[model samples]
Target: MIIDFHSHIFPPPLIAARDKYLSDPCFRLLYSSHKARLAAADDLISEMDASGVNKAVIQNIGWASHDLCVRTNDYLLEAAARFPARLIPFIAVQPLAGTKALGEIERCAAAGARGVGELRPDVQGFGLGDDRVIKPFVETVAGNNLVLLLHADEPAGYAYPGKGAVTPGVLYPFIAANPDLKLALAHWGGGLPFYALMPEVGAALKNTWFDSAATPYLYRPEVYERAADLVGENRILFGSDWPLLGQRRCLDELKALNLSTQTLNAILGGNAAALLGLE
Candidate 1:
């Protein structure tokens, strides 16, 4: 019952037009390499099979440019439909799009998108702290019963491709505003769990969850045990950030943690199933 909480895929057509997407300044900045890999649905399923992952949540990114966001999203929606059992769909939206962003969400939801994100406000050009810009996006997601998975980066960690400045300081205020939204922050909330030591901050995180996407890129397998200890096993979701990382590689690292069976099951799949309403 292993469910990967974070992964990405693009349509074959987009992959075919790699040069166009790669030309975007922001895309080039993050990808930093023309050789960067983008997986298609088939590639994802094969990796999932090889890694023993039963299901995966495909996270779409809100590119800095609105048109790219829409194009990437269109491909993601179709891919999810093509492999519904193995892949759950999520759409990307530029909060700066205002009403248009909300409209995009509506379009994807109607087409059967289960959630919204891999949202990178830093690269996407919207400050999570800017309520005027981001409120509509959050409201739209909540209104439609969709999960919110925002990208988070540890402020003190080494620089890497796609690392954003969405640290706890920038994201916590937004989380506080939407207490009811079941938000999952990728990359262990960029070390947000450490703030849970503060009595008041811990109380504000009642609805927050953290995913271990690309753990090997930044930390050791002990991160799983440490994060679970700080935030409880239920707050941790297993995520491979596949293609950027690898599902089998992430699982192998997790296996080294020697976590208790219950905790392991909760992080690997149970928590994601509950969050996603997979039952």
Candidate 2:
């Protein structure tokens, strides 16, 4: 089964919120209206069918205002309810909101949210490894057996558009500290696989995983092969970061990589299925 693990879908409420926020001069410069044009559940299924994708794990945008997280999550849950076979919902919670954020996580999980994140600390205005606030939230997700997907930032030298604020240095500490938590770092773990050979930093983060969201724009097409060689095929998964990067483009990028059938299959779907317990 082909599963794209990192994609975004904005419902109507989120669309309105996005419009309101984007109207402001400060916000308008950073994001484009293209983000607001996400496919709904039915549209997503149609696109997935055309692309030969069996399922997609969807997330909400990080730029959403405080109340919008819950509203968008509710919309995502409702969409998943209508098409559970095609969509896997991941709830977005803003850690800076403290207890309120935890409550949202609980509520969303209770309503069947399979995971929490695509958490953008830069856009969300928090540190990726802010232990005191995020620890409790992490524990809740770990306890519930849900995956934690963080939108990791690339190193300073490698920073590109849509990189957000999740630097590799910041993520190293976070992953090191939260050894037991299952983490899928979006955007090829912020170019982390390239640094995995470092004994001091690499050994402490065995549970870290990577999703190839926005990789086509950031790295060469051969990156998947190099990443699999460095991080092991089991730790990598396919992610389109769709609507921003189209599903067809991402799949074509993956196909262009000269990898073995086993590695290709793992990156395409096997790794995500195993990580999300879909097996």
Candidate 3:
């Protein structure tokens, strides 16, 4: 029951016309170079097979263009439909799009989207803490019973592409405010779990989860044990951020950790299965 809780897949046309999408600042930051891998559903399925993954949550980049967001959301839904047992789809929306964004979320939820995000508020032209602007978007996600995954990177880390400003400091208030949203912060919640050592911060994170997306590049292997210690094992999800990193490689790194089989199993899939309500 190995479940990848975070991964991205683009439509073939989008990958083909990568240059066209580069006009969007976020997309440009990530994929401006031809070396940056852009995967389609087929690529994901193949990687899953090779990595022994039973299920994967296919996500979309937080596109600045509402059109790209809609188109990619459709592709994720279609991909999940095509591989019902193997893929779970999470829709993308530019929350800054106002009612249109809410409309996109409702349409996708109706079409079977289980969640919303890898949202990059920094690139999407908003702040998660901007309640006046983001409250409705967060409300819509919660109302529809969907998990929200936000792109988070540690503020103190070495600079990298796509690492716009969302950090633990920025994410805490939002997490505190939206206590009911099933929020999964990508990239180890930009190291937010570490702050959970603080009693108040831990209390505020009652409904939050963290994913190890791109962790191999960001932290040492001790991160898993330390994060679990601070936030508990159930709060972490296995996410390779595949295409950016390999599933097999991520799995290998996780397995190499000196963790109990029970804990390892929980991180590998049990937690995500429960989070997603998967049988």
Candidate 4:
């Protein structure tokens, strides 16, 4: 019943050439040689089994080049197909690519993609909230009821290496603008519960949800409890952000929290199953 709602896996060729092709200094710094060494599907499965995670929603790192998004989605689809019971694949779409991006999403969903993203606007160099770019993509996903997972970057209080400057301020507008899209934000929506606490914004955004990915590096365990208080338990989902942050550490941190059994179950897997229609 344990599901990691947010996890990453890359093809071996990408891992082999990660150093040579990755030009973004932030991305390069975040991806150590050690990280690249463990990007295989088999390695990820072993890690999941060790952590007692029954299933993981595998997301692609869209922070690289746009071209790589399509390739990575293909690789992720293949990986999920190889291990359907263990892995659920989420596709990545670059809005800047126009019809081609829309086409990619259609093709992948037909091939069994359950969701879309870990979409990074700062790294991907586009505005997700922009109606012109995101409208069709949103319509397509909404039409199909596919979940849209976004890599929400916020001001982390302290300046961290390899972190993007995009903040919750930027992401909130997008969420507000697109109310119909079923969205999940990574890094607990990059501290979005704080903003959602405000009356004006929270009332306006009900379709949004947060994922607990990379929580160990970012916040204390009580933050999850506080988030549940602010956003409600149904709005939260478990995400390990695997490879970047291991599954064991994230789950360990979650276990330390004094959450209700129902809340814990929802955050761990129930919400994800419901969001992706795995139920």
Candidate 5:
């Protein structure tokens, strides 16, 4: 089964008011400059059906506002519950919310959230390098057996809408310190695999993996094979940051890479299946 590990959705009402949300001072940070297609869960289902994507993890962004986070996460939880077989819900909590965020995590987990993420520290305003700020949330997620996914930015990539400044440098310190945290860094960890040649960096990366969400816009399609060689095929997950880019875009790009069927299978679905405990 093809499991697209990264995607997003909003409630129909929210999607209908996309222009307003895109213009809101806070939400504008991610959507002001770019007007990409935003979909409701039902739209996502239709895309999945058309793309032949068997399942997808619905990623809610880390909203700095407590109210926004809860609103989006609530929809994700309900959508996942309504379509248990097709959607795996992942909630994003603002670390600034402190106890409230923890409570939100608890509530979502109880409601069947499989993970925590689409976390954008750059946008949400937190230092992942600071253990104190995120430790409680990390521990809560770990304690609950929920995977963590963080949005990533290359220190040198061209600027774009929703691009955050969580460079690999910032990611290294925290990821190294918390070896037990299960992490999947979106956008191929901002080209971090290339640094895996460094022993210490490679060691610190044992528990982390990279996802190819919005990859075509960031790098050449050959990056899929190149990254696999540097980080191992097992550490790559198939994540199409859908709506921004079609699921078929990533699928077609990867298929043209001429990789072995075993490696292809791993990138296409097996790796995410194992990480997410999907059958």
Candidate 6:
């Protein structure tokens, strides 16, 4: 029961009219290049079959515009409905939209959205630590029993596309403030799990999970072992960041690390299953 915790899919129409979406800075930064791949739900299903992934969470990139977020959320919900067994939709929302964003989340939760995520707070013009700005949104997500996945990046790393300033410093306060939220920080929690070595940080992150979305591009393979040692195997999730990274390629790389079968299995699926309440 292997699950890729982070992946993205677009509607065919959105992919066809990619130019129109480029007006959003985050979209423009990631998709302006012709080489950057834009995959649809069919593409994800095909790749999952080839990679032996049983299920995947469909992520939406941060869109500053509420209209863009809603448009993409509709597509995510539709795609998940079309392939209910294989896809889990994590709808997107521009938290700055206030009540409207909460309404969209309620609507999607009723329609079958399992989570809300891949949120890029920096690009979305909100600080994760800004309780006044995001508390309502956070409350709404929690009320719906939806996991919140935030985009996190290493604060000191070389710049890359979509690498905004949602680093550990910014993420820690939010985690402390909302200790009860089921939070999954994408991209290895921007290296936040490493901080779990500190007693206080570790305590605050009891409910947090980290997804290895594009780890091959970021760290050495030893990261899997090191992160597990610091935060335990249950806190790590296997996320290929599909389209940006291949499912098979990432799996092969992790497999090469020669981790024990138990540890490997936990990261690959066990942890995510428990987190998502999958049977």
Off by over 4 Å in 2: 23-30, 33-36, 156-161
**Candidate 2 has what TM-score?**
0.91
lDDT of 6 by residue, 5-88 (tens): 999999899899899888898899889987899999999999999999999999998899988889899999999999999999
Residues 141-166 of candidate 4: C-alpha lDDT, one tens digit per residue: 87777888887766756665446755
Supply the global lDDT for candidate 3: 0.92
- Mind giving the per-residue lDDT tens digits that candidate 5 earns over 1-279? 799999998778877776667533346765555466678899899989998899999998777787888999999989988899999999978888899989988989899998999898877888886667788989999888899999888899578877777888888888887899889999999888999999999988998989999888999988888999888999999999998899987898888988999999999899999998887
Model 1 RMSD in angstroms: 1.3
User: Could you tell me which 10 consecutive residues in candidate 6 have the lowest summed lDDT?
Assistant: 124-133
What is candidate 3's lDDT per residue for 25-108, written digit by digit as tens? Answer: 888989998989999999999999999999999998889989889998999999999999999999889988899999999999
**For candidate 3, which ten residues in a row score worst on lDDT?**
124-133
Pull out the clashing pairs in model 6: none
Model 1 clash tally? Answer: 0
- Please list the residue runs of candidate 4 whose C-alpha ends up more than 4 Å from where it truly belongs after superposition: 24-29, 32-38, 63-66
Name the lDDT of candidate 1.
0.86
Number of clashes in every candidate structure?
Answer: 0, 1, 0, 0, 0, 0
TM-score of 6: 0.98
Q: Can you write out model 1's per-residue Cα lDDT over 138-200, one digit (the tens) per residue?
A: 888988989999989888968887777889998889888889887999999999998998888
Q: Show model 5 residue runs off by greater than 4 Å.
A: 19-26
In model 4, what is the error at residue 29, expressed in angstroms? Answer: 5.9
RMSD per prediction, one decimal? 1.3, 2.4, 0.8, 1.9, 1.5, 0.9
